[model samples]
Target: MANTMWRRGVEWLAAAAADPRACKWEWDHGEGIALLEAGRFWDVLTVPDRLGLLALDLLWRPGLPVPGPTLVDTAAGRVGFFLPPDPSGGWVGSGLRYAAKGSWVAVPPPYRSARFLEWLIPPDGNGVLHPPGPLEKALREAHGALAVLAPMCGR
Candidate 1:
């Protein structure tokens, strides 16, 4: 089952790459990461680690729908959530960056860790992506929560 999931994850990721063959080759040849084009299969919504961690906590509570694939760049102190493409490109918030249309993203293999990057929530191999509405709400709520805690932390 693990192997099947691993292969499916790889296939799912590769299908989003500009050249799926090359992407698979790179992953198969021990490259450890594949640079994939954004907006092909999904758009990436990135946030600072400070806000993202809090948002994740809220999203993961029981009875909430599971969020799509999420990743973190430890060295960069950023977290990225995969969401379906938004033609309007209307996502807007403090500290939020949308990668879509022409942007690129470095993605680690679903089953392994990479330097400075790792999957917080690995892709489920079912092409699921976070819905923009819920994500925006979670992020906004997270921002508000952080604002409340900031003074308490002397920030």
Candidate 2:
């Protein structure tokens, strides 16, 4: 089941890259596990944590440890992205977050160093976060950022 869902995430992300409406950070959340607790902020769980939580059978109504602002919402900026808290006071933006395994970030390929929230959240400015021009531009420079990440993700 996890493999199926993971595949869906990959497919959704691949489709997003070609979506005319898909901005710089667009993604489909129906492809991932639903959050036990919904919020703007979320912690990226490691494989062990994920297994442990899944074993709970999640009877509590409070919620799950998963992430959210799922791609289910078609409205602009409805997507939410969360990063592991840093000195930057956790994540301060909203969009399709990448909280894969042990990291809450994406390298967009070629970048050896991993970035926490900087991938989606800019260091400055009040410009609209969606379709982050800088991130998109950087990815474009590397022949499509998400494209490079897809194969690496083993999707």
Candidate 3:
């Protein structure tokens, strides 16, 4: 049930990505891995920015209302549309994770899910975006990447 809701949210975000106003954020190396290592992954992106590459980290907290659809550019791809917290701030947890060929060679499981959301492309010559695929493939890839890198990471 929760996963279904999450997927719906992602779809909504993808539609929003069609907006011409949306732009790419920025990417910081190792940030996604760091989020995975830390349980507090929501710090990466929030619930409104845009669907693109974001370079900076946004702030969020329990009971703190956010204007999100928080989009950002990560090393892996354009990752965003974070999960918002419940009304009580319970489940405020979120992680817009990103992974690339080498840097993401080894990431722990805890950060697999929400950390990575969507892979996007510039569908038109306009600034609008075309986000592709579900988080499942990316999660699976991360899982696979970790398996290949884990032996070297000594875990």
Best by TM-score: 1
TM-score of each candidate? 0.94, 0.21, 0.22
List residue ranges in candidate 3 displaced over 4 A.
Answer: 1-78, 81-120, 125-134, 153-155
Off by over 4 Å in 2: 19-66, 69-155
> What is the Å distance of residue 40 in model 1 from its true position?
1.8
* lDDT (tens digit, per residue) of candidate 2 on 43-80: 33211222212222221225323222112122222223
Ranking by TM-score: 1, 3, 2
Error of 1 at 143 (Å): 0.5
Q: What order do you get sorting by lDDT, best first?
A: 1, 3, 2
Error of 3 at 144 (Å): 2.8
For each candidate, the alpha-carbon lDDT, in order, equals 0.87, 0.27, 0.30
Clashing pairs in 2: 36-63, 36-64, 37-64, 80-95, 81-95
Q: How high is the lDDT of residue 140 in model 3?
A: 41
Task: For candidate 1, list the clashing residue pairs, or say none.
Answer: none
Return the lDDT, model 2, position 34.
Answer: 18
- Candidate scoring better on TM-score of 2 and 3: 3
Q: What is the C-alpha lDDT profile of model 1 across 109-136, one tens digit per residue?
A: 8888778889998887889888777778
lDDT of model 2 at position 69: 15
